[model samples]
Target: MSTDTGNDARQQWKAWHEERTETVSAPYGPLALTGTYWIADATEGRIPAIPGHWAVDGENGERGGAVLLTATAADGLTVDGRPLSGTVRLTADKGPAAAARADHGGRKLVVIRREGLWAVRVYDPGSAGRRAFTAIDVFEYDEDWVSPGVFRPYDSRRRVSVRNADGRERGLGLDGELAFTAAGSGFTLQVGVEVDGTLWAVFADGTSGDGSYRFRFLRTPAPGVDGRVTVDFNRALLPPCAFADHFICPCPPPGNTLPIVVPAGERRVLLG
Candidate 1:
Protein backbone atom coordinates (compact mmCIF):
# COMPACT_ATOMS: atom_id res chain seq x y z
CA MET A 1 0.00 0.00 0.00
CA SER A 2 1.21 3.53 -0.80
CA THR A 3 1.99 5.94 2.06
CA ASP A 4 -1.00 8.09 1.18
CA THR A 5 -3.32 5.08 1.03
CA GLY A 6 -2.00 3.77 4.35
CA ASN A 7 -2.64 7.14 5.97
CA ASP A 8 -6.18 7.12 4.64
CA ALA A 9 -6.80 3.64 6.03
CA ARG A 10 -5.63 4.77 9.47
CA GLN A 11 -7.95 7.75 9.36
CA GLN A 12 -10.81 5.50 8.37
CA TRP A 13 -10.02 3.22 11.30
CA LYS A 14 -10.07 6.16 13.67
CA ALA A 15 -13.44 7.20 12.30
CA TRP A 16 -14.76 3.65 12.71
CA HIS A 17 -13.53 3.47 16.30
CA GLU A 18 -15.20 6.78 17.12
CA GLU A 19 -18.45 5.59 15.61
CA ARG A 20 -18.29 2.39 17.69
CA THR A 21 -18.07 4.43 20.87
CA GLU A 22 -21.21 6.32 19.91
CA THR A 23 -23.10 3.11 19.14
CA VAL A 24 -22.30 1.40 22.46
CA SER A 25 -23.33 4.49 24.42
CA ALA A 26 -26.53 4.82 22.44
CA PRO A 27 -29.86 4.43 24.26
CA TYR A 28 -30.55 0.86 23.13
CA GLY A 29 -27.09 -0.73 23.01
CA PRO A 30 -25.67 -3.39 25.30
CA LEU A 31 -25.16 -0.88 28.12
CA ALA A 32 -28.92 -0.43 28.24
CA LEU A 33 -29.47 -4.05 29.32
CA THR A 34 -30.42 -4.04 33.01
CA GLY A 35 -31.70 -7.56 33.68
CA THR A 36 -32.26 -11.12 32.37
CA TYR A 37 -34.92 -13.18 34.22
CA TRP A 38 -35.04 -16.93 33.66
CA ILE A 39 -38.43 -18.65 33.78
CA ALA A 40 -37.35 -21.54 35.99
CA ASP A 41 -36.72 -19.33 39.04
CA ALA A 42 -39.35 -16.69 38.35
CA THR A 43 -41.76 -18.93 40.30
CA GLU A 44 -44.65 -16.49 40.40
CA GLY A 45 -44.17 -15.74 36.71
CA ARG A 46 -42.59 -12.43 37.62
CA ILE A 47 -39.09 -11.05 37.70
CA PRO A 48 -38.02 -8.79 40.51
CA ALA A 49 -37.80 -5.56 38.48
CA ILE A 50 -39.65 -6.36 35.26
CA PRO A 51 -43.39 -5.75 35.05
CA GLY A 52 -45.80 -8.44 33.71
CA HIS A 53 -46.26 -12.20 34.03
CA TRP A 54 -43.92 -14.52 32.13
CA ALA A 55 -44.41 -18.28 32.15
CA VAL A 56 -43.03 -21.02 29.98
CA ASP A 57 -45.43 -22.92 27.74
CA GLY A 58 -43.85 -26.32 28.46
CA GLU A 59 -42.96 -27.18 32.02
CA ASN A 60 -40.36 -29.62 30.71
CA GLY A 61 -38.17 -26.77 29.34
CA GLU A 62 -37.42 -28.48 26.08
CA ARG A 63 -34.99 -27.01 23.56
CA GLY A 64 -37.74 -25.26 21.62
CA GLY A 65 -39.94 -24.35 24.57
CA ALA A 66 -41.53 -20.87 24.44
CA VAL A 67 -42.90 -18.50 27.05
CA LEU A 68 -46.36 -17.04 27.69
CA LEU A 69 -46.53 -13.40 28.68
CA THR A 70 -49.49 -11.68 30.28
CA ALA A 71 -49.60 -7.95 30.78
CA THR A 72 -52.32 -5.47 31.70
CA ALA A 73 -52.87 -1.78 31.14
CA ALA A 74 -51.82 -1.24 34.74
CA ASP A 75 -48.52 -2.97 34.03
CA GLY A 76 -47.46 0.04 31.95
CA LEU A 77 -46.20 -1.97 28.99
CA THR A 78 -46.93 -1.79 25.28
CA VAL A 79 -46.79 -4.24 22.38
CA ASP A 80 -45.78 -2.92 18.99
CA GLY A 81 -46.95 0.47 20.38
CA ARG A 82 -50.44 0.29 21.86
CA PRO A 83 -51.16 -0.51 25.51
CA LEU A 84 -50.71 -4.22 26.24
CA SER A 85 -53.38 -6.15 28.10
CA GLY A 86 -54.08 -9.88 28.10
CA THR A 87 -51.89 -12.89 27.30
CA VAL A 88 -49.53 -13.23 24.34
CA ARG A 89 -47.06 -15.91 23.31
CA LEU A 90 -43.44 -14.74 23.16
CA THR A 91 -40.62 -16.71 21.61
CA ALA A 92 -36.95 -15.90 21.69
CA ASP A 93 -36.33 -12.58 20.00
CA LYS A 94 -34.48 -13.44 16.78
CA GLY A 95 -33.70 -9.82 15.98
CA PRO A 96 -31.99 -6.97 17.79
CA ALA A 97 -33.01 -5.74 21.21
CA ALA A 98 -34.56 -2.66 19.57
CA ALA A 99 -37.27 -4.94 18.21
CA ALA A 100 -38.06 -6.71 21.49
CA ARG A 101 -41.61 -8.01 22.09
CA ALA A 102 -42.65 -5.59 24.84
CA ASP A 103 -41.99 -1.87 25.03
CA HIS A 104 -42.14 0.00 28.33
CA GLY A 105 -42.05 3.63 27.28
CA GLY A 106 -38.28 4.23 27.05
CA ARG A 107 -37.26 0.65 27.78
CA LYS A 108 -37.58 -2.59 25.79
CA LEU A 109 -38.49 -6.01 27.17
CA VAL A 110 -36.71 -8.75 25.21
CA VAL A 111 -37.47 -12.46 25.55
CA ILE A 112 -34.53 -14.81 24.97
CA ARG A 113 -33.70 -18.46 25.59
CA ARG A 114 -30.32 -20.16 25.95
CA GLU A 115 -29.51 -23.84 26.34
CA GLY A 116 -33.20 -24.69 26.81
CA LEU A 117 -33.54 -22.03 29.51
CA TRP A 118 -36.07 -19.25 28.93
CA ALA A 119 -35.42 -15.68 30.02
CA VAL A 120 -36.51 -12.09 29.55
CA ARG A 121 -34.03 -9.21 29.28
CA VAL A 122 -34.72 -5.57 30.01
CA TYR A 123 -33.06 -2.77 28.04
CA ASP A 124 -33.59 0.62 29.64
CA PRO A 125 -32.53 3.81 27.91
CA GLY A 126 -31.65 5.32 31.22
CA SER A 127 -29.52 2.40 32.36
CA ALA A 128 -26.56 3.28 34.55
CA GLY A 129 -24.04 1.55 32.27
CA ARG A 130 -25.03 3.65 29.28
CA ARG A 131 -24.86 6.78 31.40
CA ALA A 132 -21.34 5.96 32.52
CA PHE A 133 -19.97 4.85 29.14
CA THR A 134 -17.35 7.19 27.75
CA ALA A 135 -15.15 5.54 25.13
CA ILE A 136 -13.15 2.47 24.02
CA ASP A 137 -9.39 2.47 23.87
CA VAL A 138 -7.89 1.08 20.68
CA PHE A 139 -4.48 0.50 19.17
CA GLU A 140 -3.41 2.40 16.09
CA TYR A 141 -3.99 0.60 12.83
CA ASP A 142 -1.01 -1.20 11.26
CA GLU A 143 -1.06 -2.49 7.72
CA ASP A 144 1.08 -5.50 8.52
CA TRP A 145 -1.62 -6.93 10.85
CA VAL A 146 -4.02 -7.52 7.96
CA SER A 147 -3.74 -10.90 6.24
CA PRO A 148 -5.45 -13.20 3.77
CA GLY A 149 -7.29 -16.24 5.13
CA VAL A 150 -9.17 -19.35 4.01
CA PHE A 151 -12.39 -20.64 5.52
CA ARG A 152 -12.47 -24.43 5.73
CA PRO A 153 -15.93 -25.72 6.54
CA TYR A 154 -16.61 -28.90 8.42
CA ASP A 155 -18.54 -31.76 6.86
CA SER A 156 -21.27 -30.90 9.32
CA ARG A 157 -21.84 -28.25 11.95
CA ARG A 158 -20.54 -28.93 15.45
CA ARG A 159 -21.83 -27.79 18.85
CA VAL A 160 -19.56 -27.35 21.84
CA SER A 161 -20.30 -26.37 25.42
CA VAL A 162 -18.39 -23.36 26.69
CA ARG A 163 -18.60 -21.12 29.72
CA ASN A 164 -20.17 -17.72 29.11
CA ALA A 165 -19.31 -14.47 30.78
CA ASP A 166 -22.40 -14.94 32.93
CA GLY A 167 -20.70 -17.98 34.50
CA ARG A 168 -23.11 -20.37 32.77
CA GLU A 169 -22.37 -23.17 30.34
CA ARG A 170 -24.04 -22.88 26.93
CA GLY A 171 -23.81 -24.45 23.52
CA LEU A 172 -21.80 -22.59 20.87
CA GLY A 173 -22.08 -23.71 17.28
CA LEU A 174 -19.13 -23.69 14.87
CA ASP A 175 -19.13 -24.46 11.20
CA GLY A 176 -15.54 -23.76 10.17
CA GLU A 177 -12.18 -22.22 10.89
CA LEU A 178 -10.38 -19.25 9.32
CA ALA A 179 -6.73 -20.02 8.83
CA PHE A 180 -4.44 -17.05 8.31
CA THR A 181 -0.84 -15.88 8.71
CA ALA A 182 -0.32 -12.73 10.73
CA ALA A 183 2.72 -11.09 12.33
CA GLY A 184 4.81 -13.85 10.76
CA SER A 185 2.87 -16.57 12.61
CA GLY A 186 0.09 -18.92 11.45
CA PHE A 187 -3.27 -18.80 13.29
CA THR A 188 -6.72 -20.27 13.03
CA LEU A 189 -10.03 -19.08 14.50
CA GLN A 190 -13.18 -21.18 14.64
CA VAL A 191 -16.07 -19.14 13.31
CA GLY A 192 -19.83 -19.38 13.03
CA VAL A 193 -21.35 -18.93 9.64
CA GLU A 194 -24.06 -16.30 9.80
CA VAL A 195 -27.33 -16.74 7.98
CA ASP A 196 -26.37 -13.96 5.57
CA GLY A 197 -23.10 -15.70 4.67
CA THR A 198 -20.93 -13.49 6.83
CA LEU A 199 -18.61 -14.86 9.54
CA TRP A 200 -18.30 -14.24 13.28
CA ALA A 201 -15.25 -15.11 15.39
CA VAL A 202 -14.70 -14.70 19.12
CA PHE A 203 -11.01 -14.91 19.97
CA ALA A 204 -8.30 -13.85 22.40
CA ASP A 205 -4.58 -13.30 21.99
CA GLY A 206 -1.48 -12.83 24.14
CA THR A 207 -2.63 -9.29 24.71
CA SER A 208 -5.60 -10.58 26.66
CA GLY A 209 -5.18 -9.98 30.42
CA ASP A 210 -1.90 -8.22 29.72
CA GLY A 211 -2.62 -4.90 28.04
CA SER A 212 -5.95 -5.41 26.32
CA TYR A 213 -9.45 -6.66 27.03
CA ARG A 214 -9.49 -10.36 27.96
CA PHE A 215 -11.04 -11.21 24.58
CA ARG A 216 -12.46 -9.55 21.47
CA PHE A 217 -14.61 -10.33 18.45
CA LEU A 218 -13.98 -10.09 14.72
CA ARG A 219 -16.60 -10.10 11.99
CA THR A 220 -15.80 -10.58 8.32
CA PRO A 221 -17.86 -10.15 5.24
CA ALA A 222 -18.90 -13.28 3.38
CA PRO A 223 -16.09 -15.09 1.64
CA GLY A 224 -16.18 -15.62 -2.09
CA VAL A 225 -17.18 -18.98 -3.57
CA ASP A 226 -13.57 -20.09 -3.08
CA GLY A 227 -13.77 -19.38 0.68
CA ARG A 228 -11.10 -16.68 0.65
CA VAL A 229 -11.38 -13.80 3.17
CA THR A 230 -9.46 -10.82 4.47
CA VAL A 231 -8.65 -11.13 8.15
CA ASP A 232 -8.19 -7.57 9.36
CA PHE A 233 -6.97 -7.32 12.91
CA ASN A 234 -7.34 -3.57 12.66
CA ARG A 235 -11.07 -4.04 13.16
CA ALA A 236 -11.03 -6.25 16.26
CA LEU A 237 -13.81 -5.28 18.64
CA LEU A 238 -14.64 -5.72 22.30
CA PRO A 239 -17.63 -7.92 23.07
CA PRO A 240 -20.93 -6.56 24.46
CA CYS A 241 -20.05 -7.75 27.97
CA ALA A 242 -17.20 -5.26 27.93
CA PHE A 243 -19.82 -2.52 27.93
CA ALA A 244 -22.47 -4.05 30.19
CA ASP A 245 -22.46 -6.69 32.89
CA HIS A 246 -26.00 -7.81 32.12
CA PHE A 247 -25.02 -9.18 28.74
CA ILE A 248 -24.07 -12.89 28.31
CA CYS A 249 -21.25 -12.72 25.77
CA PRO A 250 -19.74 -16.14 25.09
CA CYS A 251 -16.10 -16.85 25.80
CA PRO A 252 -13.69 -17.93 23.08
CA PRO A 253 -14.04 -21.61 22.28
CA PRO A 254 -11.06 -23.95 22.64
CA GLY A 255 -8.37 -23.36 19.97
CA ASN A 256 -9.82 -19.92 19.19
CA THR A 257 -7.21 -18.19 21.32
CA LEU A 258 -4.15 -17.23 19.32
CA PRO A 259 -0.59 -17.67 20.57
CA ILE A 260 0.85 -14.35 19.41
CA VAL A 261 0.49 -10.93 20.91
CA VAL A 262 -2.05 -8.97 18.85
CA PRO A 263 -1.27 -5.33 19.54
CA ALA A 264 -3.94 -3.82 17.35
CA GLY A 265 -7.69 -3.17 17.74
CA GLU A 266 -9.85 -2.37 20.78
CA ARG A 267 -7.91 -2.68 24.05
CA ARG A 268 -10.10 -1.50 26.94
CA VAL A 269 -13.17 0.43 28.05
CA LEU A 270 -12.99 4.03 29.22
CA LEU A 271 -15.93 4.68 31.48
CA GLY A 272 -16.73 8.20 32.56
Candidate 2:
Protein backbone atom coordinates (compact mmCIF):
# COMPACT_ATOMS: atom_id res chain seq x y z
CA MET A 1 0.00 0.00 0.00
CA SER A 2 1.03 3.64 -0.55
CA THR A 3 2.46 5.63 2.35
CA ASP A 4 -0.54 7.97 2.47
CA THR A 5 -2.98 5.08 2.56
CA GLY A 6 -1.05 3.33 5.33
CA ASN A 7 -0.83 6.57 7.32
CA ASP A 8 -4.59 7.08 7.06
CA ALA A 9 -5.23 3.53 8.21
CA ARG A 10 -2.94 3.95 11.18
CA GLN A 11 -4.66 7.22 12.15
CA GLN A 12 -8.03 5.51 12.01
CA TRP A 13 -6.69 2.73 14.17
CA LYS A 14 -5.46 5.21 16.75
CA ALA A 15 -8.93 6.76 16.95
CA TRP A 16 -10.55 3.35 17.29
CA HIS A 17 -8.20 2.45 20.10
CA GLU A 18 -8.99 5.66 21.91
CA GLU A 19 -12.70 4.97 21.62
CA ARG A 20 -12.21 1.49 22.99
CA THR A 21 -10.37 2.89 25.97
CA GLU A 22 -13.19 5.28 26.70
CA THR A 23 -15.80 2.53 26.38
CA VAL A 24 -14.18 0.12 28.82
CA SER A 25 -13.56 2.87 31.37
CA ALA A 26 -17.09 4.17 31.14
CA PRO A 27 -19.31 4.13 34.23
CA TYR A 28 -21.17 0.98 33.26
CA GLY A 29 -18.56 -0.75 31.14
CA PRO A 30 -16.91 -4.08 31.84
CA LEU A 31 -14.48 -2.65 34.40
CA ALA A 32 -17.34 -1.22 36.39
CA LEU A 33 -19.06 -4.56 36.82
CA THR A 34 -18.88 -5.71 40.43
CA GLY A 35 -20.99 -8.82 40.74
CA THR A 36 -23.35 -11.20 38.97
CA TYR A 37 -25.69 -12.71 41.55
CA TRP A 38 -27.98 -15.55 40.58
CA ILE A 39 -31.49 -15.24 41.85
CA ALA A 40 -31.49 -18.89 42.92
CA ASP A 41 -28.89 -18.00 45.52
CA ALA A 42 -30.92 -15.23 47.06
CA THR A 43 -32.07 -15.92 50.61
CA GLU A 44 -35.45 -14.31 51.34
CA GLY A 45 -34.90 -11.84 48.46
CA ARG A 46 -31.46 -10.85 49.67
CA ILE A 47 -28.42 -11.18 47.47
CA PRO A 48 -25.05 -10.82 49.19
CA ALA A 49 -23.55 -7.31 48.94
CA ILE A 50 -26.36 -6.08 46.70
CA PRO A 51 -29.19 -4.22 48.39
CA GLY A 52 -32.87 -5.22 48.01
CA HIS A 53 -34.85 -8.44 47.78
CA TRP A 54 -34.53 -10.38 44.52
CA ALA A 55 -36.48 -13.43 43.35
CA VAL A 56 -37.56 -15.22 40.21
CA ASP A 57 -41.12 -15.65 39.09
CA GLY A 58 -42.61 -17.66 36.30
CA GLU A 59 -40.31 -20.75 35.72
CA ASN A 60 -39.52 -20.96 39.45
CA GLY A 61 -35.95 -22.24 39.39
CA GLU A 62 -35.74 -23.55 35.83
CA ARG A 63 -36.54 -22.44 32.27
CA GLY A 64 -36.80 -18.84 31.05
CA GLY A 65 -38.45 -16.42 33.45
CA ALA A 66 -38.76 -12.92 34.84
CA VAL A 67 -37.16 -11.34 37.93
CA LEU A 68 -39.11 -10.01 40.90
CA LEU A 69 -37.51 -7.32 43.02
CA THR A 70 -38.84 -5.98 46.27
CA ALA A 71 -37.56 -2.91 47.97
CA THR A 72 -38.48 -0.21 50.48
CA ALA A 73 -37.80 3.51 50.77
CA ALA A 74 -34.85 2.78 52.98
CA ASP A 75 -33.30 0.62 50.28
CA GLY A 76 -32.59 3.73 48.17
CA LEU A 77 -33.53 1.96 44.95
CA THR A 78 -34.97 3.90 42.07
CA VAL A 79 -36.88 2.77 39.00
CA ASP A 80 -37.16 5.16 36.05
CA GLY A 81 -36.04 8.07 38.24
CA ARG A 82 -38.74 7.42 40.83
CA PRO A 83 -37.99 5.85 44.18
CA LEU A 84 -39.34 2.32 44.31
CA SER A 85 -40.82 0.94 47.51
CA GLY A 86 -42.83 -2.04 46.27
CA THR A 87 -42.47 -5.21 44.25
CA VAL A 88 -41.62 -4.89 40.56
CA ARG A 89 -41.28 -7.44 37.82
CA LEU A 90 -38.35 -7.02 35.48
CA THR A 91 -37.29 -8.86 32.39
CA ALA A 92 -33.79 -9.05 31.02
CA ASP A 93 -32.36 -5.62 30.46
CA LYS A 94 -32.01 -5.08 26.72
CA GLY A 95 -30.07 -1.84 26.66
CA PRO A 96 -27.08 -0.22 28.34
CA ALA A 97 -26.66 -0.73 32.05
CA ALA A 98 -27.23 2.97 32.71
CA ALA A 99 -30.71 2.62 31.24
CA ALA A 100 -31.71 -0.33 33.37
CA ARG A 101 -34.97 0.06 35.30
CA ALA A 102 -33.33 -0.40 38.66
CA ASP A 103 -30.65 1.72 40.28
CA HIS A 104 -29.13 2.34 43.68
CA GLY A 105 -27.04 5.47 44.03
CA GLY A 106 -24.62 5.28 41.11
CA ARG A 107 -25.01 1.55 40.61
CA LYS A 108 -27.15 -0.11 37.95
CA LEU A 109 -28.95 -3.32 38.74
CA VAL A 110 -29.06 -5.01 35.38
CA VAL A 111 -31.20 -8.12 35.16
CA ILE A 112 -29.90 -10.73 32.78
CA ARG A 113 -30.81 -14.27 31.74
CA ARG A 114 -28.55 -17.00 30.46
CA GLU A 115 -29.42 -20.60 29.66
CA GLY A 116 -32.74 -20.21 31.45
CA LEU A 117 -31.01 -18.88 34.54
CA TRP A 118 -31.77 -15.42 35.91
CA ALA A 119 -29.19 -13.14 37.51
CA VAL A 120 -28.62 -9.54 38.47
CA ARG A 121 -25.42 -7.85 37.34
CA VAL A 122 -24.34 -4.93 39.44
CA TYR A 123 -22.47 -2.15 37.63
CA ASP A 124 -21.07 0.39 40.03
CA PRO A 125 -19.24 3.48 38.93
CA GLY A 126 -17.18 3.13 42.08
CA SER A 127 -16.18 -0.46 41.45
CA ALA A 128 -12.62 -1.16 42.49
CA GLY A 129 -11.85 -2.75 39.15
CA ARG A 130 -12.77 0.44 37.36
CA ARG A 131 -10.82 2.63 39.75
CA ALA A 132 -7.69 0.54 39.36
CA PHE A 133 -7.79 0.31 35.57
CA THR A 134 -5.09 2.32 33.80
CA ALA A 135 -5.35 1.25 30.20
CA ILE A 136 -5.70 -1.75 27.89
CA ASP A 137 -2.37 -2.88 26.47
CA VAL A 138 -2.45 -3.30 22.68
CA PHE A 139 0.07 -3.80 19.92
CA GLU A 140 0.60 -0.97 17.48
CA TYR A 141 -1.51 -1.26 14.35
CA ASP A 142 0.02 -3.03 11.34
CA GLU A 143 -1.46 -3.30 7.87
CA ASP A 144 -0.05 -6.78 7.45
CA TRP A 145 -2.59 -7.98 10.00
CA VAL A 146 -5.52 -7.08 7.74
CA SER A 147 -6.73 -9.69 5.30
CA PRO A 148 -9.70 -10.68 3.16
CA GLY A 149 -11.88 -13.47 4.43
CA VAL A 150 -14.98 -15.41 3.39
CA PHE A 151 -18.00 -16.48 5.38
CA ARG A 152 -19.45 -19.93 4.90
CA PRO A 153 -22.88 -20.32 6.40
CA TYR A 154 -23.74 -23.59 8.00
CA ASP A 155 -26.57 -25.82 6.78
CA SER A 156 -28.24 -24.90 10.03
CA ARG A 157 -27.40 -23.23 13.32
CA ARG A 158 -25.34 -25.37 15.66
CA ARG A 159 -24.80 -25.21 19.42
CA VAL A 160 -21.64 -26.58 21.01
CA SER A 161 -20.96 -27.09 24.69
CA VAL A 162 -18.03 -24.87 25.64
CA ARG A 163 -16.57 -23.90 29.00
CA ASN A 164 -17.06 -20.33 30.12
CA ALA A 165 -14.67 -18.12 32.07
CA ASP A 166 -16.83 -18.64 35.16
CA GLY A 167 -15.81 -22.31 35.24
CA ARG A 168 -19.19 -23.51 34.00
CA GLU A 169 -20.07 -25.13 30.71
CA ARG A 170 -22.69 -23.58 28.46
CA GLY A 171 -24.00 -23.86 24.94
CA LEU A 172 -22.40 -21.57 22.38
CA GLY A 173 -24.41 -21.09 19.21
CA LEU A 174 -22.52 -20.82 15.96
CA ASP A 175 -23.91 -20.14 12.51
CA GLY A 176 -20.93 -19.95 10.21
CA GLU A 177 -17.20 -20.11 9.63
CA LEU A 178 -14.85 -17.29 8.71
CA ALA A 179 -11.82 -18.40 6.76
CA PHE A 180 -8.88 -16.18 5.91
CA THR A 181 -5.17 -16.22 5.14
CA ALA A 182 -2.83 -14.43 7.52
CA ALA A 183 0.97 -14.46 7.67
CA GLY A 184 1.05 -16.67 4.53
CA SER A 185 -1.11 -19.42 6.11
CA GLY A 186 -4.83 -20.12 5.94
CA PHE A 187 -6.98 -20.24 9.05
CA THR A 188 -10.62 -20.78 9.77
CA LEU A 189 -12.73 -19.75 12.78
CA GLN A 190 -16.22 -20.75 13.81
CA VAL A 191 -18.29 -17.62 14.35
CA GLY A 192 -21.65 -16.75 15.79
CA VAL A 193 -24.03 -14.74 13.66
CA GLU A 194 -25.75 -11.74 15.11
CA VAL A 195 -29.26 -10.70 14.22
CA ASP A 196 -27.82 -7.93 12.07
CA GLY A 197 -25.71 -10.40 10.11
CA THR A 198 -22.46 -9.37 11.78
CA LEU A 199 -20.09 -12.06 13.04
CA TRP A 200 -18.38 -12.68 16.39
CA ALA A 201 -15.44 -14.98 17.00
CA VAL A 202 -13.79 -16.08 20.23
CA PHE A 203 -10.27 -17.13 19.39
CA ALA A 204 -6.76 -17.57 20.74
CA ASP A 205 -3.39 -17.41 19.04
CA GLY A 206 0.22 -18.22 19.84
CA THR A 207 0.39 -15.09 22.02
CA SER A 208 -2.62 -15.93 24.19
CA GLY A 209 -1.88 -16.41 27.90
CA ASP A 210 1.72 -15.40 27.20
CA GLY A 211 2.00 -12.00 25.59
CA SER A 212 -1.73 -11.34 25.40
CA TYR A 213 -4.85 -12.12 27.33
CA ARG A 214 -5.82 -15.78 27.54
CA PHE A 215 -8.36 -15.28 24.70
CA ARG A 216 -9.68 -12.48 22.55
CA PHE A 217 -12.77 -11.54 20.57
CA LEU A 218 -13.10 -10.37 17.02
CA ARG A 219 -16.13 -8.66 15.48
CA THR A 220 -16.63 -8.18 11.77
CA PRO A 221 -19.30 -6.21 10.06
CA ALA A 222 -21.94 -7.96 7.98
CA PRO A 223 -20.41 -9.65 5.00
CA GLY A 224 -21.22 -8.53 1.48
CA VAL A 225 -23.63 -10.40 -0.75
CA ASP A 226 -20.63 -12.34 -1.98
CA GLY A 227 -19.77 -13.38 1.63
CA ARG A 228 -16.61 -11.27 1.79
CA VAL A 229 -15.28 -9.44 4.85
CA THR A 230 -12.16 -7.76 6.14
CA VAL A 231 -10.61 -9.75 8.96
CA ASP A 232 -8.67 -7.05 10.77
CA PHE A 233 -6.62 -8.50 13.57
CA ASN A 234 -5.48 -5.06 14.67
CA ARG A 235 -8.91 -4.58 16.18
CA ALA A 236 -9.00 -7.82 18.14
CA LEU A 237 -10.52 -7.16 21.56
CA LEU A 238 -9.93 -8.39 25.07
CA PRO A 239 -13.03 -10.31 26.13
CA PRO A 240 -15.16 -8.83 28.91
CA CYS A 241 -13.95 -11.49 31.31
CA ALA A 242 -10.50 -10.01 31.03
CA PHE A 243 -11.69 -6.81 32.66
CA ALA A 244 -14.04 -8.25 35.28
CA ASP A 245 -14.24 -11.76 36.62
CA HIS A 246 -18.02 -11.65 36.89
CA PHE A 247 -18.39 -11.87 33.13
CA ILE A 248 -18.80 -15.40 31.80
CA CYS A 249 -17.25 -15.00 28.35
CA PRO A 250 -16.95 -18.36 26.58
CA CYS A 251 -13.68 -19.99 25.63
CA PRO A 252 -12.80 -20.53 22.00
CA PRO A 253 -14.30 -23.71 20.61
CA PRO A 254 -12.09 -26.45 19.31
CA GLY A 255 -10.09 -25.40 16.21
CA ASN A 256 -10.58 -21.70 16.77
CA THR A 257 -7.13 -21.50 18.27
CA LEU A 258 -4.60 -20.37 15.69
CA PRO A 259 -1.19 -21.92 15.69
CA ILE A 260 0.49 -18.75 14.46
CA VAL A 261 1.41 -15.81 16.63
CA VAL A 262 -1.09 -12.97 16.18
CA PRO A 263 1.06 -10.04 17.26
CA ALA A 264 -1.53 -7.35 16.66
CA GLY A 265 -4.58 -6.30 18.74
CA GLU A 266 -5.46 -5.68 22.36
CA ARG A 267 -3.44 -7.83 24.75
CA ARG A 268 -4.28 -7.30 28.42
CA VAL A 269 -5.74 -4.89 30.95
CA LEU A 270 -3.23 -2.59 32.64
CA LEU A 271 -4.24 -1.92 36.19
CA GLY A 272 -2.58 0.39 38.72
Quick one: best lDDT, which candidate? 2
Best by TM-score: 2
Q: Worst lDDT window (10 residues) for model 1? A: 58-67
lDDT, candidate 2, 1-272, per-residue tens: 89999999999999999999999999999999999998877778789877788888885563447888888999899988899999988899999888899999979999999988889999999999999999999998999999999999999999999999999999999999999999999999999999999999999999999999999999998999999999999999999999999999999999899999999999999999
Residue 70 accuracy (lDDT) in model 2: 85
Clashes of each: 0, 1
Q: Write candidate 1's Cα lDDT for 9-96 as tens digits.
A: 8888889888888888878888898987777888688788878887888757534478887888999988777788998777888888
Task: Candidate 2: give the clashing pairs.
Answer: 45-53
- lDDT by candidate, in order shown: 0.87, 0.93
lDDT of 1: 0.87
Q: lDDT, candidate 1, residue 88?
A: 79
Find the 10 residues in a row with the least total lDDT in model 2.
56-65
Pairs of colliding residues, candidate 1: none
